[model samples]
Target: MLRKHIPITVSHELVHFKQSPLKKEHTLLSTSIREGAAEFIAGLISAETDGTLAEFKGKEITRLL
Candidate 1:
């Protein structure tokens, strides 16, 4: 399963990279929100080899991307 969907993972990491600011302090809620937003954006832009992954991802994110 991991052997596939590398694009989604890359997209996810890229979102994190887009956060140019290196904050010294932030609340847990803020950090969680950041993570969640990254995930949501990545999912929107990520691709699927077939419909299978699209369906699977809709249910749950197995891993990165």
Candidate 2:
């Protein structure tokens, strides 16, 4: 589980990095938006690649939502 999560987490952070330059505040709102978008993308990728969105479920995803 933890192993599977690493890639998704890293991908999310990477998305934030790509978006960071355009973001102004980097405040809670910005952070949540960046992270949420990343997580959604990562979930999509995971579902496409791994054939399951199960990794995107549970506590972490719930918290993001």
Q: Distance (Å) between predicted and true CA of 53, model 1?
A: 15
Candidate 2: tens digits of C-alpha lDDT, residues 1-65: 46777777676667777774754646888766766687788777665232355866764644543
**TM-score for every candidate vs. truth?**
0.61, 0.51
Error of 1 at 55 (Å): 17
Candidate No. with top TM-score: 1
For model 2, name the residue pairs that clash. none
Q: Name the 10 consecutive residues with the lowest summed lDDT in model 1.
A: 47-56
35 in model 2: Cα distance from truth in Å? 1.5
- RMSD in Å for all candidates: 8.8, 7.0
Model 2, position 52: C-alpha lDDT score? 58
Residue-level lDDT for 48 in candidate 2: 25
For candidate 2, give the lDDT.
Answer: 0.65
